[model samples]
Structures are given as structure tokens and as C-alpha cells.
Target: MRLDKFLKISRLIKRRTLVKEVAEQGRIEINGSVAKASSKVSAGDELTIRFGQKILTVKIQDLKEHVKKEDASSLYTVIKEENIQQPTRHE
Candidate 1:
């Protein structure tokens, strides 16, 4: 499955266009390399997504064209999630 579609089906990003924009900006990485919207994804692939101040890492467990809201999270397993601390500004 395409990265963008997978993101949507998995309910990770909430939208396809947003995934495309995020991938284009290099905020997503697959297996330690930058990923594009069209990047192919499959089981066992590791995905690291940066969303604003939070970073999420997940391992793809399954890929489906469609899934129910209750089962969306079964697509991937979240390995880690951390907030990027912003440096305090000194006036």
C-alpha cells in the first residue's frame, strides 16, 4: 500500500493530502530513510512520523485497503512517542 493511503486507513494522519504534504516536507521516515507519499509499505516496515512537537514511531503489522474505526490501530504498533522539547527563549 502507498504510504499516504496507509496513513489514512490506519487513521494516523486523518487525511491523505496531509500525509502527502508531511512526506514531501521529509517529516516521515521509513526504515530510517525518508519516505514519499508514493512509497510502498508492507508488513514489518518501521515508520517514524514527526507531527509538530511530537514524534511517533510505529511498526507496520498489517496493510488493508479499508478498516473499521475500532480496528484502525491494529494496522500498526506504536513503538515510541516523544515530545520534542523546545528551547526556551532568552530575552
Candidate 2:
């Protein structure tokens, strides 16, 4: 599945357009490399997302065209999530 669609179908980013934008801006990575919105994804691929100051890492468990809200978590496994401190202005 396409990276952007996977993100939405999996309920990770909440919207396909947002996911595409994120991918285009290089905020999303696959297998440790910057991924494009059209990148193909499959099972067992690692995905890292940068959401503001927080980072989320997950491994793709499965890929489906559609999934229910209650079953969204089954699509991937959260490997790690961290809120790393970033340099602030006026130090």
C-alpha cells in the first residue's frame, strides 16, 4: 500500500492529505530513510514519524485497504515513542 494511504487506513495520521504533506516535507521515514508519499510499504517495515517535538516509531504488522477504528492498532506495533527536547530560542 502507499505510505500515505497506509497511514490513514491505519489511523495513524488521521487524514491522507496530512500524511502526504508530512511525507513530502520529510517528516516520515521508512526503514530509517526518508520516504515519499507514494512509497510502497509492506509488512514488517519500520516507520518513524515526527510530530512536532514528539517522535513515534512503529513496525508495520499488516496492511489492509480498510480497517475499523477498533482494529486500527492491529495494523502496526509501536516500537517506541519519545518526546525529545529541542533547542529553544533565546538560550
Candidate 3:
């Protein structure tokens, strides 16, 4: 499945457009390589996503076109979450 679609279906990202934007900005990676919104995602693939001050790493556990809110968390397993400091501005 498409990376963007999977992210939404898995409830990782709340919106499809945001996924696209994140992927385009090179903040998403798959299997240690930078991936695009159209990148194909499958079971066992490692996904590292940057969300604001948090960096999340998850391994894809399953792929589904539709899932309930209660079951969405089952699609992927969180490997780690790290807090990152934002870059300071320089004039």
C-alpha cells in the first residue's frame, strides 16, 4: 500500500495531506532510506517518522484497507520515541 494511505489507515498520521507533506519534506524514512508518499509499504518494514518535537520509529505489523479505532494500534508496533530539540534561529 502507498505510504501515505497506510499511515492514515494505521492511524499513525491523522490526515493524508499531512503525510504527503511530511514525506515530501523528507521527514519519513523506510528501512533506513528516505521514502516518498508513494513508497510501497509492507509488513516488517521499519518506518521512522518525524512529528514536531517527537521522532517515532515503528515496525509495520500488518496491512489493512480498513480498521477500527480500537484495532488501529495493532497494525504497527512502536519501537521508540525520542524528543528532539528544535533548531534555533540565527539572524
Better of 1 and 3 by lDDT: 1
For model 2, how many clashes? 0
Q: In candidate 3, what are the lDDT values of residues 1-91, reduced to their tens digit? A: 9999999999899899999999999999999999999999999999999998999999999999999999999999999999998789999
Rank by TM-score (best first): 1, 2, 3
TM accuracy, model 3? 0.92
Best by lDDT: 1
Cα lDDT of all candidates, in order?
A: 0.97, 0.94, 0.96
**Global CA lDDT of candidate 3, please?**
0.96
lDDT leaderboard ranking: 1, 3, 2
lDDT for 80 (candidate 2):
99
2 or 3, which is superior by lDDT? 3
Model 2 misplaced regions, further than 4 Å: 88-91
The TM-score leader among the candidates is 1
How accurate locally is residue 35 in candidate 1, as Cα lDDT from 0 to 100?
99
